[model samples]
Target: MSKNSTLILEVKNLAKKFGDYVAVDGISFDIKESEILGFLGPNGAGKSTTINCILGLIKPEVGTIRIFGKDLFKKRSEIMQEVNYCSAESNLPWSLTVNECLRAYSALYAVKNASTKIDELLERFEIAEFKNKRMRNLSFGQRARASLCKALLNDPKLLLLDEPMASMDPDVVDRGIKLLLKIQKETGMSVLYTSHNMWEIEQVASKVVFVNHGKVMAQGTALELTRQEVQLEAKEPDLREVFIQLSRKAPEMEEK
Candidate 1:
């Protein structure tokens, strides 16, 4: 792929095995510029493992992950500079204030103009009031906001998010969704996000990849998936309905 091409991330025949069990079995996908691709799967469905391989946190025993047409493992450092990840459970240092945490992360990423970028993110997330508060002192919602700010500190071209709004209030969740859309619009960033909240995926995802048993079972626009499930007798085939239909087997109804 050409460097100027819109494809930012590519996973081809990516598979990982732990002792004889395959965690992710030969999955392939691509994320394009300015697209929000929802990675949906039930619990323990290899979603996290696939993401780890893409992030180079774990080496897949087979296949390749390419970012900007560069080999992911061989060019990890070069790729990491333009990519970042945030998870709901990932935490900053408890002893550090929010500002301190951001500063440390900025330095780690070798971000230029770190202070200015940190300030912009702080203001955008409206976390300036807690800038001096210790990480342990912040509420779950506040910490989620801080985590998002940290992820955005590098102005990354690719953002990997796992349950990005898991701890927020409904209002904050809405705000965060809006923020993500705005960021994608302004920066043309590509996002690969996983969330159990189907409604949020419906709202923000440009394309949805539904995974099951370590493979992609279905992928398309949310509307297309919903429409395709009309024959399944669902009253209204939304993402949740489509997800349940594809990921589970119906129990046999008892005879009258």
Candidate 2:
């Protein structure tokens, strides 16, 4: 792909299955460089399964995942060197100090000038004071910051974030969002982020993919999706409204 093409991550007909259950039913999408793509869906709507397929963490029953025009599974090492992920449930070693964990991740990613990068991230996230604190001693917000720092340790070209703002205070979430925007601007990294918070997604995502029943029900800019709903004469058309219209099991009664 040419630099001007902008496509950074591409998924074509991706599907995943566990015995008789299909988690992702041949979903496809692409994320472009310097773009923050939001993956939105209800619980068990295959968001996580799709992410796992993109990361090559689980083998999909069908379809292809390409990073920078290279097959993700065939070129795992090359793909991984330029990609990273952060998720809410991912844990740090409880016995390791914050600094140590960062260093360990830096080593794993073979980041040059690892110590300098770790120090810079520590200061950037305002966690320098807790650098020597054990992982078990850090609050949930602090751990989230640390996870983000680790994900960016190698300065990846593609960053996958699953609820990056979870467990963060309002102040911390503000800081984190700013830091994420700054990083994307500086490094030109493409981000594929999943979130349940419609407000947060509206704030950060340039485009969105809405999934339901293991398939993409809608894909467009957030504003486009909202407007589409309004054109359909749906009551109080908004992202949440569209989400409910598409995925809600029962018709939601509009409050008087």
Candidate 3:
């Protein structure tokens, strides 16, 4: 999509706290239509906290969130219909089969032709063989793929994914990335993808946002961020090197 594409999501100066500790501090970012914005941060940099605020699952103490140009707080119910989230930490019913879990979500999302959609997602994730397998019986990678299928059941206009490929084998991860790219191209869907896999982000994201200590430390295309000598000290200017440098260097600022 063009840089002029409509903004699918906008978060401005978001902040959140847990009593004595700050979880999110003055974070801001936006996602444009059909764009994949990769959110990069260290373990405690509040990436997940920011995502929760965007999903309306957690209220921020300060700041505004808008999705599709509408106030997320005021139009949460309506806005959520067009948004979906998937994460490695999320879980489906342990006793239910993959097919059963997906069928239930399709109904919840009020998806039409649910059967066909479910089958297609299963095939896309290469998990059709495990459709009838119970969630507890599947491996971590398999379960993660199943959760991803659930996220797409509604064909959400905005998708939030956190470490969705964390445990997948390289081959499956590649296929999953390709499938997401294909879907995004065909549907103009926007994705807020958070992952530690710098290589994966470099492959799929057009823009990357780096956050440390709940603040946006930097953002740009992968090449731009890597090329910035002050922002990254990588000899080769690679994304993985950039991540390591930022994590080490940015954390010191968190305490100041």
Candidate 4:
């Protein structure tokens, strides 16, 4: 990250609760412009809840969310114009053809030069062959590519991706990851990335936040956390081992 990098997204003391259970508890983090930040956690952790709050899909009972140096709630319309989100569970219209889906999403964002954007996205994702294919008919890997194409329609400044490579084969996953890195580098958009693949995280993320049971347990570069407490052979440390080490320990024992 640049020394004077601007913060594109800020979550301060964010909390979300459901009934008697706390889904997310007072977590705070920031994504710098032109940075990739990974959000990781074990199953049943508060990862999803925190993401929902950040996207404004669910209201947080406490804390504030700021995007582009403005309050998310008060400036939602303005903030959303340059912000876009995507998840592997993208429930796009199954009957719609790929082109139709992209067109509709572009209209929703009111993007100009719609046809040009659609073609560029399809070619970039290597999904132009399936432009006429229906969503329900496409394979999981193909659909994943289409889903990403839709997310890029608006040329967003901030992108939130939740398991963007889910259901993709090794080759497709590699392609998708590279495309994201390229977009960020060329456009300087901030990306908040979430996935279960530790190796993928190590490959793309510049910083990481590990949360469990609605609380953040650790925050640092992958190398920092992997080597800080665990002994290694001096070669690159595995992120999965670092995750296991952090999650398996008692909260009191893990570093704050």
Candidate 5:
């Protein structure tokens, strides 16, 4: 999507703290319709905290979150209807079968023809064969795929994915990314994707937001961030290197 695309999510000056420890400090970013924004940062950079704030799972002590141009805290129930999130950390009931878990979510979303939607998603993820398998019986990668299926059951306008492919094999990760891009293109859905795989981000994200020490350190296309780090000598921009360089800096450097 372009800059002209309707803004799907806007976060301004968000801050949250645990006593004297700041988990997220003055973080801000926006996601436009059909845009896949790569939310990049090292561990403890508050990327997850920022996402949690947007989901309204944790209220921020400062700032506002707007989804679809409405206050997230005020219209959260309404806004959540058009939003969904997926992460490796999100767990399904272990006793339930994969299909059972998906059915539960489809019902929650009030999806019409839930059976058909579940079937399609299972097929898309190549997990139809494991539909009846208990969630606990599935491998890490299989469970991740199942979580993804549940996330899309609502055909969400805004999807938040935090390391959704962290445990998947390379082949599955590739397939998952391709399917995600295809769906986003056809549905104009916006995605806030977080992953440590810089190559994967380069492949899918239309824009990049880099956070450090709970603040936005940079925001731009991957190429732009790469260029800011090093002069390109007729070579391709390397986002991984950019990540490395920024991640290695001392916390004091972020104040500059």
Candidate 6:
């Protein structure tokens, strides 16, 4: 969050191309230790492609990804022990119960005392009642919580989430947000949070990056994004206003 904080992740000159289409165009950013970085963009705005590159799910034609100041591709085995990813779109096996899913992931991360950790997460997420429920049968909110629980199993140094509170009720959303903030404060874990919800992003992220048409439109805190407008109009502007203004522009328009 602080400009002086240690950089935990760096994406330098990252570019991903899908045949002739350039999905990501030489984007670069840094996530500081214990910082919550909100990655926001319109649909088809290259957010997914950039995230895929960061997670090592896809290789970019250009640029390097460094985690903990080490090359991610070269040190993947060692670095991944401290990194975990979660998304509402990725599903666990339908046959696996909530407990089973947690158990499976814990084993993957080689967590010790996994059963005890799973119990603690189940209670923390308030999903203990559904711990034995199959993934296929769980409601969207239930599955979302389960995914988050799994991400925490390793006590990772970095957590990557896409639409983390998707389909959650108000109460659950509040609790989940609180828990994320608590984890950031206590463990000093860095977070890369992608969400379509600007309000949610403002509530959680210390800084945000907005991408449009395969390039970075803006990167700064909510206040900084709206600062110019507020200064010009002598009124406060919310992040959504700035987001829309930036995301809808042509590159030439941006120059002007």
What would the TM-scores of all predictions be? 0.91, 0.91, 0.94, 0.94, 0.96, 0.94
Name the lDDT value of residue 148 in candidate 2. Answer: 90
lDDT computed for candidate 2? 0.84
Q: Residue 148 of model 4: what lDDT?
A: 88
Quick one: best lDDT, which candidate?
A: 5
Model 2 segments more than 4 A misplaced: 1-3, 231-237, 249-256
| Pick by lDDT: 1 or 3, better one | 3
Q: Is candidate 4 or candidate 5 better by TM-score?
A: 5
**Better-scoring candidate (lDDT), 2 or 5:** 5
- State in Å the error of residue 178, model 2: 1.5
lDDT of 1 by residue, 1-256 (tens): 1133488899998888878877787788888878889999888778999989988999998998999789998899999999998988856888999999999999989989998998889888888899899999999999999999999988899999999899999898998898888887888888999999998998788889888767777788787888775454434439988888877843232332
The lowest-lDDT stretch of 10 consecutive residues in candidate 4 is 247-256
What global local distance difference test value does model 4 have?
A: 0.86
Q: Could you tell which candidate, 2 or 5, scores higher by TM-score?
A: 5
**Candidate 3 regions off by >4 Å?**
230-237, 251-256
Worst 10 residues of 1 by lDDT: 247-256
The residue pairs found clashing in candidate 5 are none
Q: For residues 1-256, could you state the per-residue lDDT of candidate 3 as single tens digits?
A: 5566799999999999988688899888899988999999999899999999998989999999999999999999999988999998757999999999999999888999999999999998889999899999999999999999999999999999999999899998999999999988888899999999988998889999999888888898887888872454444437787787777774434452
lDDT tens digits by residue: candidate 6, 76-118: 8899999988887757788999999999999999999999999
For candidate 6, which ten residues in a row score worst on lDDT? 228-237
User: lDDT values of the candidates?
Assistant: 0.86, 0.84, 0.89, 0.86, 0.90, 0.85
Ten consecutive residues with minimal summed lDDT in candidate 5?
247-256
Superior candidate under lDDT, 1 versus 2: 1
Regions more than 4 Å wrong, model 4: 232-235, 252-256
The C-alpha local distance difference test score for the whole of candidate 3 amounts to 0.89
